[model samples]
Target: MSKKEKSTSVNKKTLGRILKYIKRYSFLVVLSLICAAISVVLTLYAPIITGHMVDKIVGKGAVDFGALKTLAIRFVIVVAVTAVCQWIMNILNNKVTYHVVNDVRTSAYKKLEQLPLSYVDSHTHGDIVSRVIADVDQFSDGLLMGFTQLFTGVMTIVGTLCFMLSINAVITVAVVVITPVSLFVAAFIAKKTYHMFRKQAEIKGEMTSLVNEMVENQKVVTAFSMEENVNGSFNEVNKRLNKAGLDATFFSSITNPCTRFVNSLVYTGVGIIGAVMAIKGRISVGQLTSFLSYANQYTKPFNEISGVVTELQNALASAARVFELIDEEPEIAEPADAYVIEKADGQVDLSHVDFSYNKDVELIKNLNLKVEPGKRVAIVGPTGCGKSTVINLLMRFYDVDAGAISVDDHDIRQVTRESLRDNYGMVLQETWLKTGTIKENIAYGRPDATDEEIIEAAKQSHAHSFIKRLPEGYDTMISEDGGGLSQGQKQLLCITRVMLDLPPMLILDEATSSIDTRTEIRIQRAFAKMMKGRTSFVVAHRLSTIKESDIILVMKDGHIIEQGNHESLLAQKGFYYTLYNSQFAH
Candidate 1:
């Protein structure tokens, strides 16, 4: 998990999961292997025929044109067939690689939907994207080369060994004995670099995460004039990535040469011994020539395998990360008898709720509150007072550690999450708008909304006034998160989204904080009309907005220190009085 240390050893369990995907296209895999097998056979046959040609020419002590012509034709046919098979195998390998990677990406995306909010909170957005996109891509490329070489190399080694044994067993034994040396060298280097590759992958994910965070928050970076600082931070991450990449490549690069060196030693041993055997008359000159060629062929596969080994190691590391994502625990299972609500009457209740993101650091504890149907409730406190945490609990973004939250007297945990969320509307200070036309953004929550309903909702949040003035009006394209719109305009569009939902309950967290006072008053009047007969929980800092609330819950350290209407709490001169005084009395 550290910068240098990594779990690079092939995780058999995770590898097993990765291999399970091969079953989805078993026929293609088998066909690829078959193509490799046939290609190896036809290709190896040429060397044998050449050896025969040598014997026939030497036996008569003259060239035989008739036999030579026939041999040449046979050679041409074999070459064509072998080439075609190799091409077919290459095509199939790519087919399998891409299809499998597609499934991997799809599976990761679907898993994202089922994963808990806490899971997303614990991971970086760029890291998630890296595994789902970049890592999977590497995995596919590596696997493509891996499978292509694996089947061919294995068949070539096996077929060449068999031929060598038949021609001259003594030289074949030399090759067989020396083959293990190459294997040992490859294994050792793979072990040494496995950690490097795994560490490199981890660093890549970190770099991706850092870059994504900086890019997404460019506004904040520029506003703070931290350009130099951001560049320095990026350089730091990039330097680490460079070192890891260099280390991994340096080790893997040596493997090919090491295997080739070992193969050269095997080739020398075969040549020397086969010549001696030929001089002893135990094997003919043709046989000796064939044996040497066979020995070279035998060692060639192992030499080729050095590259394959490194590729597989990298693929395994990528597979481990992808498997890690796929294996993550999804959301907790819904109860067998969980509440399934058909409708809610806007009654919201919470009692004796204890919770904390971390066990040792309690945030919200022993909390209790009740809001009657159609009432407007407001929560206010200084920052870090758990106002947003309260809203998170109500939305079941995080479950309470203890006690219950109910909607219409039904425990929220028992209800299906879809039904629970579908019944409430929310408009937060941080407006979220996607890249689309102006109308699409306002109707995001209710995709099936008609033009009349969308316009009505936009009018309610006072978004229509500005929207209509645009060059294309409702059809005007907005970039991601409403790029052209001001913060206040974006917020109104978000509030309009909620209005279109028309849910039984509403939660507004600093909904009008970004709007100018004049616009704020208009939106507040619109909100007052919307909350006429629906429960609403408003987390606000501006005191004037919530002055007529049916209940004002002043929170501190996650508890309601004071709860009453605007006037009664002010009459008591409790926390609300000081909170109100600090703003207006200034």
Candidate 2:
């Protein structure tokens, strides 16, 4: 099938899955239906009572006081009952919608967690955030208002049609003639509105992303004095969003007014026809009056049906976006029969591994390496020479396109991703600390770790001193993303957090790049102590950091060109020797 056809099929499947998400709330749906039925019954009686009043007055040529009183009392009762039912329905609908929204949000987040790292790398954070916030909120409206409006509209239309036909089939036919025309108008507008709404949602997501970028990179913008440029770009996106929103609003806005106009015309025609029939002595004055009331009542339900048509279209548009996200296939997933590795000695071996982030460009090709248990292997390469890619593959962030990676005699792919990753502790180039106390950050790696264990881990990573210097030490709260801490401080806290877990294998991808040389030396010392008797892979540009490693590998163009001990490789005067000379010679 063509790509567009494939996408259409996928979207359909996604919608089906979303509908299934509502299955758990069947009870709430039933309750809503009950409430809507009650409201419809009450509303349907309004025209009947008016007809009764008209008939009584015309038949007796005077008001029937007792009968009028009874009709009035019944009308009041219906109105009060409907009011109560509507209030209860609103409460129940909100409660159910909230629960469904919570489930959707939670499920989306869980999918994010389970998704492989490549999916995250390929997708923008802003797009994902939009799905989580805006898209999900849109579904909330669909769940609460969409279902209720649709149900009530259908009921009102059916009920009104029954009563109208009962009054006079000729008048009913005249009023009902407008049904197909109104539907056509509504459907045409809804289709146009759907396109506009989808465009609006897309632009809104883009705007959100731009705002996120500006906020996250405020420092860079200030440093480069690019506020004007950023603002111009932002305004451009904002204008597009405004235009799309206006288009959608225009389409939705015309629906109700047009429907009302058509209904008015139909009602006027009904009155004229009823008058002619009454004057010809074909119908009583009472019947003519009753028909007029029913005709007016018919218009109200059609108007409601038109409104529901617009809302349902909007809901479908929103659902399409939401399903788009939930249907996205993760780039990496565990095998069906994957085994769990409870314990690992961390003997990492990469044999003839070839990998690429994209087609036609190989990031790592025919790379072979081995690190014995408890050995420290330092990987050194120039910028963009697949240094980080190695770490990514080692952590199973992205599966290798060819060859195999084995840890302790078990191929990484043969085991469940969680079990395979459980043996490793990683401190990334970018340090990210969540909003919490220093102790909490340390305990993040091992939630079950005791307070004493946390403090010891902090001390081992040389983070305890500065942490204690803070106002509340371990109890001091950190901002989201560790906004309160300096780069070095954040790095130290992240290192401490990783150390607390004491994973069997460790990957430090430029772990100390943010610290000053002196601080780097101190952190290196702490890292060395932690690295003892543990398998570790260190990716660093600094020559000083890797001097004490058991083995050093020089990589270029995704291939391991040189490998040996620091002293031996320095003596060879090859790639490693040239790299060391260049850095130290400067």
Candidate 3:
């Protein structure tokens, strides 16, 4: 789909979700409506009293002090009561909007967590962040402000029409003749503006993504001297955003002014008719003055309604984007009848599995593998040979298209995803560490792990010595992604985290690839110790790391070309022999 079409679809979904959110807080909505009604009634009384005052002052030659004082007191009391009601309405509206926004933000965040890895792989991080933070925030105007003005505007229009019609039907009919035309014009402007606003939001998300990419990869850009290229891309997105913003603003600007012009015409016509009636003595001066005031009051509400329509359109655009995210089906989810697989003994088997990320291209074809309990199997493969795909299938990150994977004699598909995942500890190639103390990072696998257990795990992974050498020992705070540590240290930290979990099964994907040769040797030794009595799958590019494995599989082009013990594979002098010789020849 085109970007515009995708954006429109997303926006419609977002709006639907927003309505659901509003429904969840129906009690608050009802309360806000009650407060708005009370405030509107008090507001209407103010205009009526003002009109009454004008008539009394002009119609009576001398003021009746007692009657005038009573009218003034009643007006003040009504104003005070209305002011209180408005204050309550404001408080209630704020509370409702805050709760709604809070729920939206929370829901958006949760949805992000539940989303499959495939969804994240396909979208930019900044774009998703913008939806959660910026787009969700826009709902305040969409739901709260729009709802408030709509309620008040409707009440004002109805009340003014009733009072005006009662006093003088002819004048009321004349003033309201253009009402339908004004509404049609407002609706037309709103529809046009909605598209513009949706475009503006999309451009903003793209710009946000661009900025995020530039900031996160600033080092790479500087190293490659591609600052100019980065800046050009950023400028392009910024220009689109600027153009869309200007268009939306220009369209929104016309709405209020046009409505006011139409209202002005109505007021002028009403005055002319009222003046003629007064001159012919068909209506008293007081009545004519009162009728004029009501006509003028009527225009204010229509103008407010026009402005609100534009805001509502913008809000709908935002809501639609949010809903699209919430509506997405997760690529990976627990089966309806998923059972818990507790006490896994760690034996893993992949039988006749076929899989692909895209339908037409199979990444892994008819793959079969088995790892006995407490066995160390190392998979050595060239780049893009489906080495990681094997690990992904073992962890059930993506289900097989055909056949089944089993853990401890149980088909993994029948187990709850969480229970299956809980049985394994993984140390990925990329060492991702949150900002926290060294102890916290290590204990992340088991949050409730005691300090002693954390220290022991760190020691097992050879991270304890380096951690202790730091200024604060276990208490030393690590920057995000372990910024304060060396690459080797970060890898060790990830290893320590996994060790702390002490799961029956383990998968280490290039766990020591980034470390120095010397550190790799130490990490390998630590890993060997951890794998003594556990099932392990190790994907390594370094042949030296897997030479002593119980079984070594040499893979190329997504298929295992050779599999045997180290000596047996070397004896065959096939794909495995070629790879080992080629690496040593370097």
- Per-model RMSD to reference: 2.4, 2.3, 2.4
lDDT tens digits, residue span 1-586, model 3: 9975765566566666667777887887788788888877777667667666665676546656676788799999998988887788778777877888888788778888888777887888888888888887776777777676777788878888888887789998998897676787787888788889888888888888889888877889999999999889988888888899999888888888888888888889988999998899888776777677777778887778888878877877876777668667765666798888786888888888888888898688878888899999999978999999888888877778998999988899889888888988899998888899888888886899999999888888878889889999999998886766888899898899998887888899999988888878888898888888889889998888998799897888778888988899999989888888989995
Please provide TM-scores, in order, for all candidate models, with all chains considered together.
0.95, 0.94, 0.95
- lDDT string for model 1 (1-586, tens) is 7543344334566567778998899999999999999999998888888887787688555878799889889889999999999999999999998888899889989998888888899899888888888788878878888888888998999999888877877677878887898899899888777677778888889889999999889999999999999999999989988999998999999988988998999989988887888888898887877777777787888877888888878888887888888889988778887876666798888989988888898888899998899999999998998999999999998899999999999889888888899888999988888999988998788788999999998888899989999999999999986777899999999999988878888999999999999999899899999988999999999989999899999999978899999889889998889989989984
User: Which order, best to worst by lDDT?
Assistant: 1, 3, 2
- Write down the lDDT of every candidate, Cα atoms only: 0.87, 0.82, 0.83
Better of 1 and 2 by TM-score: 1
Better of 2 and 3 by lDDT: 3
Better of 1 and 2 by lDDT: 1
Local accuracy of candidate 2 as per-residue lDDT tens digits, 78-179 = 899999998888877787778878888888887777767777788778877887889788767766766666677777778777877777788788878876
Alpha-carbon runs more than 4 Å astray in model 2: 1-15, 58-61, 281-289
